[model samples]
Target: MRIADIYKGNTPVLSLEVFPPKPGYSLKSVFRTLDGLSDLNPSFVSVTYASQGESTDRTVEIASRVRDEYGCESLAHMTCISHSKEEVASVLDNLEDRGVGNILALRGDIPADFSDDKRDYHFASELIAEIAARNNFCVGAAAYPEGHIESKRISLDLDNLKRKVDAGAEFLITQLFFDNRIFYDFMERARYRKIDVPLVPGIMPILNYKQIKRILMMCEVSIPAKLLNMFDKFSHDPGDLAKAGVDYAIKQVSELVEEGVEGIHLYTMNRVPQVREIVFRSGLREKT
Candidate 1:
């Protein structure tokens, strides 16, 4: 099913994002994680893409399993970085053949050693244009509520987003955010710009201090002072920190839902227990 269709109804949609195992990891553990998450009854699950050769195969394999074996709709992610036009087409063809109906188009991070002059695709808008030409997939693109790390200004970011939509993105899912106010402000800007597709807010419950710090730094997401203080006070206690993280996510989600946002996507990080707790506590399970 197209993720955009899932948002057509009045009931709020709840989704999960899971990544394929890295190069040397076993697929067994990832399948196990999917098995555990299936019980939460996500509106759909999105499988992230990997640029590595073997892991790329696993990306489609697991996404097909999510729909075929687990009886859930799947959105397969495809990134254009470090790929030729033919390579991107082949991946899309594979996804269509496997019965996966949705895609999240991305211009993934470029390695420090890679040069842009040698790249076939540089921006996500270019990739979205290629996908649009195929006219066979429901496409989703990423949005940054707090301007993207690489972007100089949020206005520029929204302008780029408009280009993606014009190129044929059906819907959008935002990067993980800690503050609801930021998301609300982003929506206003997006609407004013006339980029009016369903914008689903992405949420990631911070389970550990070290892990979250690393991710926040990489994504260039600002940590709220309140959340920073919580981490400082409970950094020494893993159990307490985990509980606090779940609570914080629940609070964030609850407010988003109350605001009548179109959908919510959880960056599960392959941790079923934390996601399950947030869904149940935030009353998402009841609505979905």
Candidate 2:
């Protein structure tokens, strides 16, 4: 089913994001993660894309498996940064063959050695239009609540987002943000701009000191003082740190649900136990 349709029929749609294992790993571990999270009743599971050759294939395989193995909808992510228009068309055919109907179109990080002459797509808005032209898959795009790291300002990001929606994105899922206030502010600006698709908030649970540091570097998200203090006190204690991270997520999810969020998209990091705890403790499943 189209993810947009799912949103139409369901309230507070619960979703999870899991990536395909890197180049030389088995799918066994990811399946196990799904095994543990099955009972949370996710509206759909999004399989992240990798631009490399075989890794991209695994994205299709894993997304189809979600439906076949678990009887749930799947949202397959497709990155356009490294792909030709021809390559993307082939991917669309493959997705249809596998009965996967929803997609999250993205312009992944541009390669350091990227050459303009060979690029078929420069932005996600172009990719969204391509997928929308096919009219076979439901198209979704990403939003950065605090503005994208590459973007100079949030208003500029919002302008770009409006164009993507105009180009054919049916809905949007945001990058992970620790501060709900940031997301809340973004939502207000989005509505003011008249971009009226379902705006789902993406939440990433901070699991360890290393992970937190890496997220800061990669996403450029601002860390709230409460979280900074939590990390300061618990970074040395893995067990306590995990507990605190999960607790923080529970609070975030609970408050967003109370505020009538259209959905909660959890970046699972392929860790089921943490995600399961967050969903239950936050009362997401209970409300469903």
Candidate 3:
């Protein structure tokens, strides 16, 4: 089923995002994570593609397995900035052969090793348009609740987002954010701009203090002052920090669901236990 259709169901959509195992690593671990999460009944499992193509095959394979082996709908991420138009078409063909139908089109970050002038698709909206023209798969796009890093202002970010929607994005999944208020505000702004597709909030549990801090720095995602404080208090204590991360995510997801958000997307980071805990504790799913 298209991920967009899942949101229209009576129950809230519960989804998890996972990445392909890195180059030179065995797939055993990631499959284990899937096994651990199977009982959670994720409405769908999305596999992220590597822009550099190091794990592209693995991404397709994993997404296929998530459907064929795990009995869950799967979404495969496609990064077009680093790929030629032919390359994108080739990938689309491969995904179709694997029976994967949903795609999250994105203009990936430019690699430091490559110059910008050589790419075929310059923006995600362009790629979204291309995929939409195919009419074979359901396409989703990424959104930033606070604002995109490349955009100078939130209004500009929303403008780019509107282009993606107009180009044929069926739904949107936002980047991970700590503040729910910011996401709500962004939702209102996007709706006012006439981009009325379902907006799924992405939530990542703060598993590692340093890693989360570095991500916030790179993505420019705002860190609520209180969350920053909690990180500081637990920075030196790994065990305590993990516990705190779960607790915080439970509360965060609980609040989002309470607000009647159409869907909640969890960034699993390939860790199943904590994600399982968050789903049950957040009341998105039961312990059964």
Q: List the candidates' TM-scores in order.
A: 0.97, 0.97, 0.98
Reference-based lDDT, residue 203, model 3: 96
Error of 1 at 125 (Å): 0.7
For model 3, the stretches where C-alpha displacement exceeds 4 angstroms are none
User: What is candidate 2's lDDT per residue for 167-270, written digit by digit as tens?
Assistant: 99999999999989988999999999999999999999988789778878988989899998998899899999999999999999999999999999999999
For candidate 1, the lDDT comes to: 0.89
Ranking by TM-score: 3, 2, 1
Which should have the higher TM-score, number 2 or number 3? 3
Backbone atom clashes (below 3 Å) for every candidate: 0, 0, 0
lDDT of candidate 1 over 1-288, digit per residue (tens): 778888897557888999877778889888989888898888899989875444677888888999999999999888898798888888888988998888899998777788778789989999999888887889989999999899999999999999999998989999999999999999999999999999999999989888998999889888899998998889999989999999999999999999999998999999988888899888889525
lDDT by residue (tens digit), candidate 3, 92-114: 99999999999999998878788
lDDT of 2: 0.91
Local distance difference test scores for all models: 0.89, 0.91, 0.91
Ten-residue stretch with the least lDDT total in model 3: 3-12
